[model samples]
Target: METVFIVAAVIIALLLLSLVLVKQGHIGVVTRFGKYHRMMSPGIHFKFPFIDNVFNKISIQHRSIELEFEAISLDQASVNFKSLILFSAKNSDEDTIKKIAFRFIDEKSFMQTLIRSIEGSIRAFVATKRQSEILVLRQEIVDAVKDHLEDSLNHWGFHLLDLQINDISFDEAIMRSMSQVVSSNNMKAAAENEAQAQYLIKTRAAEAEARSIRVKAEAERDALELKGVGNALFREQVATGLAKAGTIMDAGAVDPALMLYTQWLDTMKNVAAHSHGNILSFDGSNDGFDKTFKQMQLINKSLLEKNTH
Candidate 1:
């Protein structure tokens, strides 16, 4: 009865060692006599007792890590980058799981290679760009790193899911200098605009002033022409009246000298009526009046003869 109990105990221990449980999101690699044999899926998996062993359990889930590093730009400026990287196993195929299991000595070594590859790719890209271009090339940098790392990671049975650049920054002095450059450019644009505006204003003012002068000169010329025309018309009317008066006097068989004397008297009366502070010194004697009237008569006789001719 004691021998039977020993055999049963050994069987139970063998059974316990043969059964393996693999949790969700994980894959178990089985090895026979320390040599790779097959892969075990999640849940209860039976293997040869004391001959097959659970070699390595690899998680197929996505994993993330934060990275902070510095890169030197082509312009010899230091750029700091903060980023997050997501990675996972390529697939669940047996060959893929085998590659992942045997790619590196351990998870730590695989992670080191991955991190170094990412850093190398980033540094190489950054070395070719200027400091001013680094801030806006976050997506490009991520793309370049993925492109450079895709084949390498695939060889190790891994895939790059995502890469995020959280922050990019330059040195304090460089930042201040960049700000000054932008401010100066804005100021230059403002100055150019102000100069153009002033030029337009002055040009318009000069044009307006010239137009005003031209208009005033035109108005004065028109006024002078109208006044001259009015004066000419008045003189013509007076000449006609005098000629008619002379003709009437001659028909009546009256002396034209009598009409001349009456006109001289009328002129003196008008001068006296309209005089403001003007002095009129004229001869009041009949002899002086007769002399002046004779001169006027001579002038009128000559004008009438010329008109008749």
Candidate 2:
């Protein structure tokens, strides 16, 4: 009876050792006598008691880590970055699981390698770029790191799901200098805009003034033309009146010279009456009086000849 009870107790212990439970989001790696045996899914798994070992249970779920590091730019400026990295196992396949389990001695070693590799990749990229270009090249930096780290991460049975460069910063002095540069540029732009607006206003004013001057000149020209026409009509009417008066005086048995002299005297009297502050100077000698009389007799004679013809 003692031998029977001891054998049953050993069987029960073996059964307990053989049962392995892999929880959700986890996969189990089994090894037989220090050699790889098989993979276990997330459930109750049966194994050979005392023969197979559960080496490591790797979680296949997504994981994340934050990184902060410094890099030197091509211009030899120190740049700091805060980044986030999201990663996970490539897949739950046996080949991928093997690489994840055997790539490093432990989780700490793997994490160290991953973080160092990311840092190295970022440093390499930063070493080729200028400090001024770092902020704008955030996406490019991420792409370069991805392309550079794809095969390396794959070799370790992990995928680089996402990489984010959240903050890029420079030294305090460099930041202040950049801010001053931006301010000066903004001031220059504003000054140029103001100058352009003033120039436009001046140009419009000059154009309007020129247009007004042109319209005034045209109006003056039209008024002069009308005045010249009126003067020509008045001269024609005066000549007609002189011819009619000379004919009437000749038919009345009066000397035509008398009528002409009388008309000249009346013209002088009217000029004297209506002259405001204007001077009416003439040759007042005997030669001037005879010359005026002769001119008046010639005018009457010309009118007489016209009537006879």
Candidate 3:
């Protein structure tokens, strides 16, 4: 009875020790005699008491870490970077879990290797680019690092999900220089735009002035043409009236001298009526009038004889 009781007690103790409860999202790595034996999924499992041990509980869930590091550009400028890295165990498969379990001594060593690999890849890429190109190539830097690290991380049974560069900045002096460069570019653009606008305004003004001068010249030319036409018509009418008067005088048997004297008297009367405060300096005596009239009568008699012929 005593032996049976001792045996029963030992069995109960072994049963209690063999029962293992693995948490969700984690795989239990079992080892026998300090060597990897098998992987246990979440839930209850039975293993030989005192021989089988839970070596490591590896989480298969996604994990994230923040990184801050400095890199030197090709131009010898120091650039600082702030980034986030998301990674996870490649999968929950038996081979992947085994690799995760045996690859590193502990989590600290794994993290160190991971971070250094990322930093090295980033530095290698940045070393080839200038400081001016760094800020704009955030995504490019991430891609270069991921491409470089993919195979290596797969060997460690991990997958890089995402890499986000939160901030990238240069040193203080570089920043000030960049700011001044941008300001000067803006000022140059403004000056160029203002010059173009002024040129357009001047061109438009010159065109308007040319149009106005052309219009004025055209108006003056038209007025001169009309004045010349009026003068020609007036002279023609006067010639026609004088010829008719001469014909009438010949038909009435009137002397040409009488007609000449009458024309002189009419001309004096018109000058007196139209004169503005001006005196007529002409001889009023009959002898002086007869002398001027005799010259006009001789000229009129010659014109009448020519017209009759």
Candidate 4:
């Protein structure tokens, strides 16, 4: 019975000694004989009672570090720049985090060094580029720095997620000058655009007006040509009719006195049929047409009688 109780107690102590609680989002590295044996993931884990040792525990979490400082340009101008760096440990094991904890400084130290290096690089970049280019290529400079830092720090078991410039402060005078230049450029572009729009509108309006005038002139010319053709046709018809009448008269098929007497009888018949009352007609200033007719008849009768005798 005593031997069984001692055996049970020893088993309980060994079990207790072999058990280890690893938290969530963490990994534990076990080492044996001062060398890496295996890595244990989160939750309860077991190890040999005396042979295995827990070396280090590491977190698998992404982290961020912010840094801000001033840098001087090649032109002796002070620039205030602030940046944020996102980084994470590539390995999250007991041994790796332990090594990192002892061999590597904290995030703040790393961020300071990173910011200093980035500032130096930006300075060199700005020296080669104009101030305008610097402003335009600020993102490029940031990316370059991030790439360089990631490459350098990857060996140190760290991965750079990103590095970005939050703000860049310039000298007041330089800022004002830049603002003025931008304002002037915008104003010039606006004026040029306005001028171009005005020119296009005027050109279109002039073209439309010219087309309208041309159409009106063409219509007037066509109307005048039509009118001239009509007038020429009427004059030709009148001339042709007059020529035919003259030819008929010259042919002597009908006497001139007979034509005059026919026309006079037709005129007197039309006037009598349409008259409202009796009309006393006169020949020019003669008192009556009857008296004029009597005179004409007497002259005709005398001529006729002379011919007969």
Candidate 5:
């Protein structure tokens, strides 16, 4: 029984020593005779007991790291910038990742190296550019970093996913000055707009006044012309009426005295028709209406006899 137990223990120990397991999304590097033999995928894997070794395990998964750096502007002004970088192993080559992993003990040291490279490149980029250029083309800087990192780190099995610039802080004085200048420019523009508005309003008012004066003058001129036309027409009508009256007189062949007496008699008849029984005081020598009527009839009859002769 003692010999069987010892044999069982030896078998178990040999089984444990020869077996290797790799999880999902992971690959194992198997070394034989102290040299790379082949790669093992996720599952139970076998290796020579003492000659073959599981050198490294590499994961084909996404990873990210944050990076920060300081930059100096064109005016020798310093600025602080921070960003995040997301990367993943595109190639599942365990040898390549193992080489990279061996250079740096862990993910943090590898990230530190990447951060230093990024910072150096970004600072160089910013140092060559002016503050205005940096402010205008920040996206261009990010693109450049992404392109460079993707190209440089690809051999290390890292595929760059994205680079994000989170925050940027400029020198206090420069920031304050930019703010002041922006505010002043806005105020100047506002004042210019107000002045232009006032000028337009005044100009429109002047034009309106000028138009009003012209209209008033035109109306006055039209009224005077109309009055002159009316006066001429009135004079012409009066002259025409007088000429018609003269024609009637000539047709009748009557003396002026008889015509006047006929008109007076017509007026008296009209007055009598309107006055029903009203008493009318007369200016006479107490002889009354009979005396006045007899005189008028005598005068009218004499004028008529002269016309007949």
Candidate 6:
């Protein structure tokens, strides 16, 4: 009874050891005595006990990694870059799985090679471009890296799904210089616009002032012409009235001197009552004030001669 139980327990242990359970999304590569044997899919799989080794499990699902690096441009500018790369197992074929299992010593080695290949390709492309051209050539850089790395990745049983250049920048000094250039351009544009606005405002004001002056001159000319007509009419009426008064006074045999003296006294009373501040200054021109001055002089001489008599 003890011998039979020992044999069954040994057989159960070997059975358990031979059963390999692969997880989802992973493809398992089996090796026999340190040599390639077969590939196993997800689920429980059986292999020769103690002979077949589950060498490596490769994921067929997409994998992504972010990379940050620096490179030099053609003009010796230090350019910094952050990128995202997506890759996966080439396919679930026997050859592809075998290649994936035996390509490199381990996953770390394979990833290092892949990263170096991408970086080297990018640096090579950047070496031919100036610093100013790098931002605009993001797509070109991606394409070049893909083209340079596609075949190599395929040989290792991997597919380069996508390569995205996320952020590209320059060193601090270079970035500051570029920013200043843009700022200066904007300032120049603003200054030009402000100058144009000021010019328009001044021009409009000058035009309005010129128009106002022309209208004022026209109005003054019209007023002066009308005033001349009124002055002539007033002088004619005054002369006619004085002539009638003189004729009436002579017919009635009234003293013309007494009449003149009364008229002078009445004129003085009217001036004293109506003049502002009881003070009046003549214009001193030959138009009206100079003639009034001469008439006053003749009256003063007449008054003096009468008093002397």
Model 6 C-alpha lDDT per residue in residues 175-196, reported as the tens digit of each score: 9999999999999999999999
Q: List the residue pairs that clash in candidate 5.
A: none
| Higher-scoring candidate on lDDT, 4 or 5 | 5
Each candidate: RMSD to true structure?
6.2, 6.1, 5.8, 10.0, 9.1, 9.6
**TM-score of model number 1:** 0.60
Cα lDDT computed for each candidate against the true fold: 0.90, 0.91, 0.90, 0.72, 0.78, 0.87
Which of the two candidates, 3 or 6, achieves a greater lDDT against the reference?
3
lDDT digits (tens) for residues 1-309 of candidate 1: 999999999999989988899999999999899889999888899999878989899889999989899899999999988888898999999999999999899989988988888888999999999998888888999999988888898898988898888999889999899999999999999999999999999999999999999999999999999999999999999878877888899899887778877887898789888989578887879998778878877987787789889
For model 3, the stretches where C-alpha displacement exceeds 4 angstroms are 1-16, 208-309
The sequence of per-residue lDDT tens digits that candidate 5 reaches over residues 1-309 is 999999999999999999998999877877788777888888998887999988777777777777667899766878788888887777776656566546566767777778887887788788888886687767988987877788777766678888888887788887899899899999999999999999999999999999999999999999999999999999899656644654587689854444444656777778878987776555556576457656765875674576579
Alpha-carbon deviation at 84 in model 3, angstroms: 1.8
Give per-candidate clash totals.
Answer: 0, 0, 0, 2, 0, 0
Task: Output the TM-score of candidate 6.
Answer: 0.63
Backbone clashes in candidate 3 total 0
Instruction: Write candidate 4's Cα lDDT for 1-309 as tens digits.
Output: 999999999999999999988998777777887677888888999999889988766667788767766666556666777888787777774545655544544646655666676667666655665555566677887877766677666656667777888888788998998899999999999999999999999999999999999999999999999999999999899656644654575497643334334445677778888988798364654556456555544654564466469
The residue-level lDDT of candidate 2 at 130 comes to: 95
In model 6, the runs with Cα more than 4 Å from the true position are: 196-309
Give the per-residue lDDT of model 3 (tens digit) for 154-273.
999999898888999889999999999999999999999999999999999999999999999999999999999989998888768777877798799977677777877898899999
Q: State the number of backbone clashes in model 6.
A: 0
As a TM-score, model 4 comes out at: 0.64
TM-score for each of the candidates: 0.60, 0.68, 0.66, 0.64, 0.66, 0.63
lDDT of 2 by residue, 253-292 (tens): 8777877778778888799889895787777789988898
